[model samples]
Target chain A: MSSFPPFTRLAASLPDHVPFVGPEAIERERGTSFAARIGANESGFGPSPRVIEAMQASAGDMWKYCDPENYDLRSAIADQLGLDVEMVVVGEGVDGLLNLAVRMFAEPGEAVVTSLGAYPTFNFHVTGFGAKLVTVPYRDYREDLVALAEAANANNARIVYLANPDNPMGTWCEADAVEKFLAEINPHTLVILDEAYCELAPASAIPAIAPLRPNIIRMRSFSKAYGLAGIRCGYAFGPAELIRPFERVRTHYGVNRMAQVAALAAFADQAYLSEVVGLVAAGRERITQIAEENGLKALPSATNFVAVDCGADGVFAQKVLDNLIAQGIFVRKPVARGLDKFIRVSVGLDHELDLLAEALPKALATARI
Target chain B: MSSFPPFTRLAASLPDHVPFVGPEAIERERGTSFAARIGANESGFGPSPRVIEAMQASAGDMWKYCDPENYDLRSAIADQLGLDVEMVVVGEGVDGLLNLAVRMFAEPGEAVVTSLGAYPTFNFHVTGFGAKLVTVPYRDYREDLVALAEAANANNARIVYLANPDNPMGTWCEADAVEKFLAEINPHTLVILDEAYCELAPASAIPAIAPLRPNIIRMRSFSKAYGLAGIRCGYAFGPAELIRPFERVRTHYGVNRMAQVAALAAFADQAYLSEVVGLVAAGRERITQIAEENGLKALPSATNFVAVDCGADGVFAQKVLDNLIAQGIFVRKPVARGLDKFIRVSVGLDHELDLLAEALPKALATARI
Candidate 1:
């Protein structure tokens, strides 16, 4: 390799491979487009019409930079959540916020805890920052709050991550269990409660905003239920003092102007959010039914996606996912050993789901071969 | 102060103040809006009609996550620059790209070089990364390139930053001088040439990209003459080896979907860009005239904004800025010592300039008090 300016020892050590390969890359590789865009856990139901109108109306005003403080959006979010404005901070998305959170809390070589098969972006950040990861294995396909708390305390970790209504497995812990987990974890360990899928999840799976604690930061997003993933907007709410430190390291103008408008409109359109939540619920049911008809066991999901156990092991699930892709359906599976028996599929439009339903049986048969 | 989570020692030591406060903040604080939104060096003329139409048309598709590879946008940028796609990396803006650059090159306590009174966000990143920043003051209102190179060499700096057609001062060094600086700088140092205002600059001010080098990253933005600041899109091109590391740390989906669409359309509509450049040149002339009309000396500008010397010191220039803001004409000034004698005003719509013209005399008179 040609010699160049030296990267930080931490940065130099990180692997080049990203946590997720986007569907677009797969499409380019296959040299054909997938008829069903049912991967990446994005809502195909799309944003509310009001949000679309808001974005369209403001499209011409792209000459101005976004409000660095995100004042208006933060106020609106605080008002909706009944929290102080100082407690809310918005960023490019939950992904951006996670990067900041890790940079803030976890020093290089310090321990950071998360479930083994949780959201990989968090792990990517931890590794990027040179933090030692202490991964607790998932218990019964749900994030085991008890094991995570123990690992965090035992390792003296600086940050502990838990994604409720989690990705890949689409399983969630109840609100009471979450509250107990918050109470039990080491207070010095910042628990990043990634509730990106909160709006799509059952109300019982979400904790109340009242009696907020310093150790936990609750992340919410427009990407899931509001269906504004492409706009790249998410917010994290916690105690005021904790939230203040994000300003130290965040890219001040990272959130674009259109995202602010789209998110504000989406937040205001609760009627549309409710309707999408209903749609996601129905879609999940349909996906589960499809999995059953194809002789696979779909895990009970509190998210917009379902993880269907492929009746074999990691190789079998991978083969099934590959065959689905080959059949013009974009779907994914967990890569970690214990969770690899499952293939995760996101809810899409009805026609897309119909395409999935048509493709599943043939894909399974091919995978068996 | 109450103690919560333990931030990294570097993060904890950094200040909480943001680099720039948005004008909306002033609007909120004063309970009034500025009639002229020309403070932040944003293009009041806005993005092209085609870009707007593209963004508006894609408003409903906010449900899909952005292509993490940024393939199409990077390809577009690379083709325009006569470079391979591997040499290009798209980001949220130059601000976001700057952060990545700092993270990639500067380890804690390592040295970085830049002109004092240049872009504060770059300095913010340097500090955030725990890098030792060695500042070289501008000479004759332009970045002292010789001094910057010397400082980088003396300190064995990991990075050297120079913004051609620079911010705040609206000044630039010629292409030959820049090329000389590039040649003289230590090979181990990564030079970041921020050419954000290159489009509005005289053609001779920007160096040709034909002679590509490993140690330099040329940062460009859609935020300047392209008039898409609000979309928060920018790209950096450099040797592929240098560019590849950015993927290791960048928030893959950090650039939103709307930004990609707007920027692609903006890049394609070069005719609109040419028109905007002409308008910016005309606006710069008009602003210079306005400054002269008010008995202030305006620096000749190659960028969209002019730095008008208030014929006084830093305090007097601040007074002019305050009075303009008080009169609901949003304008800003340099906070650095030598350059702080001038108040920077961005080119705006005709009526906004008229409003600035109306406010300048009274503000100057009140400051004389």
Candidate 2:
């Protein structure tokens, strides 16, 4: 109602559409659970036994408020990354950090550059902050870094985002190309390299942490390789000067106490992480083989998920995705223009994949008709 | 360093001091944990057993990201508060929600009104957003509503914040005055009535939820009486139209899975909540007795904590606080110019209050110049 409290002008003009819907809601709507839980890029392996133990052990301490400074977790990440603790700031997740970064860099109406089909959450934050988005179409199913850099330079964009071993497309460029892209970034633009999947990707595909660029912030999450998404935790590393501004606006106590504890314990159990990564790799291969057998081409993936081209138009891909959903398989499709011809699937447990194997043939046959 | 981030002019000018220093940091520095953990106003009474059980049971779900919609929690809160689900928005905490509310309503350099020594976190968010803070001094130790509304009208302020059974001072106004203040509010202005301590206060002090004003948003937390502080959850309820804009800027998935489970369980266990409230009221009496015996004036409190007038200035209050800390007691003081004469303390367990009683006289003697 116009009689309602006045929202600031920027907030008044913002759209009401959310970026993505959760599978839980879909299940509630469909009145049935998906047999194959391979959507949303979450780890089927779950958190480490040590992490669960730590969380349970600390359950009684839920009476106390969390450390607002996030001191210990930042120190742990800083030590692991070969950087000072000041170079790090952790939040609810990469999603929360992305929102803060957008607000800090791009005020209202400034252009921000990213791939057309990169993480929709990043675009959501850009739009949430009233920033103008300038998209560079994916080239070869990978983020077109050269074009993105050019767009940033031409538009004098305030921020540029890229996700290596990216979502929906499941492709990555090697570290050398990433380094070169970093070098070519416009002086006025800050680059946010979201490496949420880096731990699961091939080592060579990740840029080395040593030569940390001042204008670049690389965000990581315990949600993927470490498997604690429900805890709502993630971290970003960058120049101290760049990172410090986040304190000005971030929800200081945004990260829950269990999250800080779970993430810390998850990080401590490197053995569990390695084991999960190995299992994910094997699952990805199994998925690729299944795709090949079905006469569809799964993209060469360096991350925990595979994006399979339906070998047709976006309409065909949507039909296939719908068939999969109808067949009780949970999977997601890319919605960005030109990137819409593929469906992305995360690596689930063995039995879950078995369900996928059992259901995909029928879903594909139905789509074909 | 400046080369790393060209922060927006507003961000660059923000002061670096954090809103609150955590007690754990104090414990770590002091090499001993505090006997009385009352400074943060946390419910030393702890959360309900059912809440703890629910959290433990849901610990394994850490791998799956929490439902971004917080569908179940929102519905439960809405049903309890007699509002539509769409009118209730969950956030990390009242602090987190305040940040969003201020941003959605207040513009840079515009005035936002609050009592002089109310919640520092609210002030933190206001200043963080570049709004000029207009303060009304407390009258006879209570938040002066008349002064606050007058200041709001004079400054043409877009937002005003009031905390019932207010923080730092542990005082409140009657429901009639609060209703009058809301009715008299300018249509262009939004009033944030923070009822975080409402559950522990007298029922007559809080207005009925059905009488919704378009410009009013009331915040509630499970932190105080429910004792789920470490879980970091709170909610804001307002008219549907006013509440919808929060979707534009909020960190949707910020509240963790455990928080949702715990909060639901806490809400369901009304018997446990009533028991905790009884204990808190008794503990407040105990704290008052100790203060009165020591010749300090303990203010009448509706909240879980008591604010004791230390019979001296802020520096002397700091001495009393420091001496208590040195003696392994954790307590805090309000730092506003007029309100600095009182030190705030939460009602801890009997043994903890016993420790406070034993230590106070020696600390008082030493605190004197």
Candidate 3:
């Protein structure tokens, strides 16, 4: 145990495991680029032309530091949400906000609750802060909110994480159910409602942005339907007191100037966002159709991606995913026990879906063999 | 105490004081933008044309999430520094990296040593992580290496932060003095060697890249000399063992995609960097000359900023700063006791510098009255 340059006990306990293996890393490993990159749930529909223009226009302003207050961006987001500006705080992304939220609420060795296969990034933050993770298994491939509420109470967890219109599964709960789940959790247990995929979800799936709760921080991102994943901007809104503490802990200039400019541009283009959503809905249907054509069942999705049941087990789904990668159509699958039979694929361009459609049967055949 | 939705004891103890109020916030309060944004020590020279071109070229690719590995950018930095890729880790900025470093090394209630009023952002992080900050006052205008080393040893500090070509003062120690300071610190204490302004410093001021010490993590940034502050990209390099822990705690996709592209292009365009460095040097001389004309003494700077002493107290210096802001020339002053008499001005464009020169005498007169 060489303790030279000693790390904190928590840091030493952490394994050097990255939460997500980026597609670029996979491409490097393969010594070639993926022909259709649909692995990471990023919007394959690029940002609005206006966002690209805004980014290009602001390219020369990179010498200036970001406005640490994030006034304009927060004001826009708050105005849209029908909330006061003080209720909102912007961060690098939903991932970045989660890191701050966990640090604020979860003390070392205290429990934090989430679904078994919810966002690994949240779990990463919780563990990074030395908090114990208490997981509740999904029910019918959806986050079992009731079970999560129960687990938080059972463990006296400091934080509860739930991603609506969830990732890796593409299933969702309606506003009423979420509201009930919110009411069931203890006020001491802070709830992080990560709505990263909210734009792609049906309106019924999202709660009205009113009656702000003291314990709940609702997160939103431009990375999904707005098609600016690379910009890494997101915001969390809650009670004013809850939002104020973030100022005490956050990296003041963490949100880059480009992100502020691009997100503002993206937020203003509601027409472009709606257009992307429609396209994403259409892409989701095409993916479902592709799954049916390959004699597999695609789960219903309110997200930009569809989860197709590969009709076997975790091993089979992994084999199918690997074969898709082998064929240069990057795809991923759930790793949780009950949900592992599904392969998740994002809605890409028509040509990319064509690549997926062309490669799926071959991938399935190889998995069968 | 109204502890519902509890924050950690450490978080609750922190004041909502932002480390540095951004120039934009000041402008907002004044209900107008600054004529010359020379504060924050950001390069007003702007990023290279090639970097801007790279950003514009990659605008449409904002739909794709950044490569979490930061592979290509890390490889480029490692190659230039004559170090292994594993030794280098790209972060959102040096600010973001400092957050990680403090978290990794300093446990709650443990001492972390640095000079008083060195970099408030580092102090912000130290307190944010619940670490006990033990400060040694600056000797003269420079960061007193002897006092810092003594404090680290006496306190058994977990980490010691030193910025060569120190911020707010622009004073630096030679490589030999720094090497001696490094040798004096205990092996168990981590040293965050921030060389953010290293590109502007003379060659003799920077220590050699090789013979990497186990206890030191050297930080460098594109935010300063490369003029990419808005992009929020920087890297830290050290022994592989120390660098590996960052992956365990960092926001993997925090550095936006445009940052990666722009920083790579910026790093590749060395001619533009040298040109900017030359321009900055000339600007420093002009600022010094202006100080002389105004009958003020400007500190010799190894960075892009010069600190002009007001020859009075902090109150008089602050009044001069306020008057300069009133005239629409943004600048800052060190808030530490000994350093507070001086106002820090960054090297801006010729036109911006003209504004500073035009305003300085008026500002001094106002302060005197």
Q: Identify the leading candidate in terms of lDDT.
A: 3
Q: Model 3: residues >4 Å from true position, as ranges? A: none
What DockQ does each listed candidate score? 0.85, 0.73, 0.81
Error of 3 at B4 (Å): 1.4
**Predicted candidate 1, C-alpha RMSD:** 1.0
For A2-50, candidate 1 gives per-residue lDDT tens digits of: 4677788888888977876899999999999889999889999899999
Cα displacement (Å) at residue A161, model 3? 1.1
Per-residue error at A32 for model 2, in Å?
Answer: 2.3
Residue pairs whose backbone atoms clash in candidate 1: none
Q: Label model 1 with its docking quality class.
A: high
User: What would the TM-score be for candidate 1 when compared with the true structure?
Assistant: 0.99
Tens digits of lDDT, candidate 3, A238-299 = 99989988999999899999999999999999999899889999999999999999899998
Report how far residue A6 has shifted in candidate 2, in Å.
Answer: 1.0
The residue ranges of model 2 lying beyond 4 angstroms of the native Cα positions read B1-4
State which candidate, 1 or 2, has the greater TM-score: 1
